[model samples]
Target: MENRTPIPDLIRLATTTADVDTLLQMMETFCHHFSYPFDRPLRQQLIRQMLENPSLGSLWLVVDENRPVGYVVLTYGFALEFGGKTALVDELFIEEGHRGGGKGRTVLQQIQQTADELGVSVILLQTEKYNPRAKRLYESIGFVDQERSTLMWKRPN
Candidate 1:
């Protein structure tokens, strides 16, 4: 079919506010279906804030077939253990149609490459155990669980 490609076509690039509205809608739908969170206003505001901050890291997006397939947003932070600014992959989501297609691994590898180029000491992320498929993907990419740190968040009031 015309829709099918002989080669896997995926691209990752920086994101801008022009992409926030659509990304928020996608994130909202993803959260709701997965019993996650869906607050469009907050997502919009978060994206805006990240866009305005140079230290907030970059949004390396995943696109396939000319449409956004997913995104990886990483922020940098100084870690005493690492002794430098490390990257934390705060968000990574693939569109429903692209799931199980093995594109996650490809995108993740791309990010790792970028991290190395940036001289990042670490790349970290969190995911639920219920998401075994995702867990496996991370494992294959050499991500081991950090036994020392536990993430806690206080969402804004």
Candidate 2:
């Protein structure tokens, strides 16, 4: 008889400088896939800062079979509109081959559980309009379209 047991998905928080390399690799892969601009040095700095400061946010590695296959970033914030603590899913990416098999949704469920544990009132994320697949996934997971305000950003020179 052959034994079969389902492999449990793991979400491990990157809590030290040691994990930065894997996180960076995942980030680079994600950026390349989406054609998003990336500055390696600044990205490393930001990851380090987040690791050092719990209040800023968290970086997590999604592992299966002891190998990191993806990563997710959650940045914390305070908002009166949300009525308390809130978080933004800054980035979520599952490596090319590992996607489309429920990994992304599993990671999101883990994030929501963590948010509940931390008293986070809301979890927000954005996806490119051109990517209907992503938008559909988000919608399926209960994230509604925000019709009120357009998200705008300004960078200080």
Candidate 3:
């Protein structure tokens, strides 16, 4: 028999209550890595609220040996441009010590598979322009740069 290794079940949807603490810890790490200051209590409250609402978004925890090491968030939208449903990979973060060993690519592939299963016609994401390493990984996985438009955002005060 040919030697075959089991495919690891690393990517999984985060449970509303069961995975809240793990998700929060990963979110804090993500914010720190990207230099975004957040109010912990408010953030926690928001996450809890979102967990109760399925339409808000979906969060997945990347685990190894049943312990979470990273997370990804996908927010949904409906648009005629994409012919139906679309989703944005809002955030993807792998802990400091757990990075740079193909985990990122594995997680992305799993995301793609999940998108296919969820009837999402399009999956979108953006990274800083200067982050060449991330850009390369995204491209390697068949994500193309959209040249026709730029992403803009507005924050309500």
Candidate 4:
């Protein structure tokens, strides 16, 4: 007998408005876990936008035996430095109970495959400095620190 980690069945691309509620709920949980502010209206709007225009990105739901266990948000971009198409792993959240069972790694592997198929020249992601576990997981799967600070600016509303 051999022991094997079960491969999670991730819903690769969320393509309908029907997934909004699940996405919002999971996103809220993710925000809380990371101590980030949860803005329902803004998040809802963004989810709707992504659903309406897949060119913007994709949302993947991690499922186990028909139950939703986690979700991932991947957004697209283009940069001359990256040779054109790029994908950002905007968010990846595995429910608390589902963590540490290889689900996250499996999902990331699938994401990489999808990106390759889409002609993405690069895949990028950021992890919170406070979450060493996540950083380790990412590094174990071939994501490396770019050795550059990531600065952001939000336009005034």
Candidate 5:
């Protein structure tokens, strides 16, 4: 039998302003690790928006023994191709110290279960090309590569 780490009991939704700071700190760490530029102001605004509107999305803090270990973000959208409501796993980060040991896999499994309960028809996510470890972890949890290229256009700043 394979030994697995039990899911922590501290996965809590970020529903209050008090959670913003903690989320920002963790997000900064995540972006830095991935070499993504951290736009603090924009991220702060987006986080607040999600908090104010449950219909928009949700943010969850992954905690272990009362300390935050990582965070996940899910944004809701409607997709005809998906047959209706879809969830984009906008961000999922497990701190370096907490990497491995089955935490990431467990969290993703929980996300799928939650999405099903919420009537989401599909869940989508993208990983960086350089981060094969993350891609493998996601695939191990049943996430598949759609083989479609993703393109984005940012509004002129």
Candidate 6:
């Protein structure tokens, strides 16, 4: 609680691991955006497995007035083209009930500050093609649309 603020608590990378369960629950709650495997234990295991990997990512929960309102997950990346480290904002979510109070913006600005502190040149993020609201939020916070799209392959197939 050292960096805790009145509305947006500022937590560093390492301090967030203890709240992994809350993070997992939040992900599961956003079922539309998440494909949950449906067992608490499995999710907990996956969360731990992720935390153990240095390159996997770090999660920060946005606690406001003592309750978690949103969260951010950032993973590191290197771009020889950009010539330094960049951060991929893998997931950012604010609960539906907490949607429009400027809390999201505050939390994101904190993320940007974190990126700056890490000497990262850019922050990469993506939103659903249909999530116009989210796109707008990101744009307002200086996140620009990348000229690229994602391509992927099934991991266990």
Model 4 misplacement above 4 A? 1-8
18-130, model 1: which lDDT tens digit per residue?
56765776777678778987777887877777778857777666788677877777888888887687998887888888888778888777777677777788888888868
Query: By summed lDDT, which 10 consecutive residues of candidate 1 come out lowest?
Result: 4-13
Native-vs-model 4 lDDT?
0.86
lDDT, residue 71, candidate 3: 91
lDDT leader: 2
Residue 31's lDDT within candidate 4 is 94
Q: Model 6, 1-157: lDDT tens per residue? A: 4985554454435345558868777877765555535577786776676678856667777776777766788888899876788788877777888879887778778887777667788878877787798889989988888667574668795
Query: Of models 2 and 6, which has the larger lDDT?
Result: 2
Once fitted onto the true fold, the runs of candidate 2 whose alpha carbons sit more than 4 angstroms away are 1-9
Candidate 4 residue 71 Cα shift, in angstroms, is 0.5
How does each model score on TM-score?
0.82, 0.91, 0.89, 0.88, 0.88, 0.76
lDDT of 6 at 109: 84
Best by TM-score: 2
List model 2 lDDT by residue over 1-157, tens digit each: 9895543556889876668998888899889888999889999999988988978998999988878899999999999999898999999989989999989888887888789786799999998889999998989989999889889999999
Candidates 4 and 6 compared: the better one by TM-score is 4
Residue 57 in candidate 1 has what lDDT?
79
TM-score of 6: 0.76
Q: How far does residue 112 in candidate 6 sit from its true spot (Å)? A: 0.5
Among all windows of 10 consecutive residues in model 6, the one with the lowest summed lDDT is: 6-15
TM-score sort, best first: 2, 3, 4, 5, 1, 6
Residues 73-111 of candidate 3 have per-residue lDDT tens digits of 888888899888888998999988889988888888888
lDDT of 4 by residue, 19-82 (tens): 7788889999999988899999999999889888878888888887867888999899999998
Evaluated at residue 76, the lDDT of candidate 6 is: 83
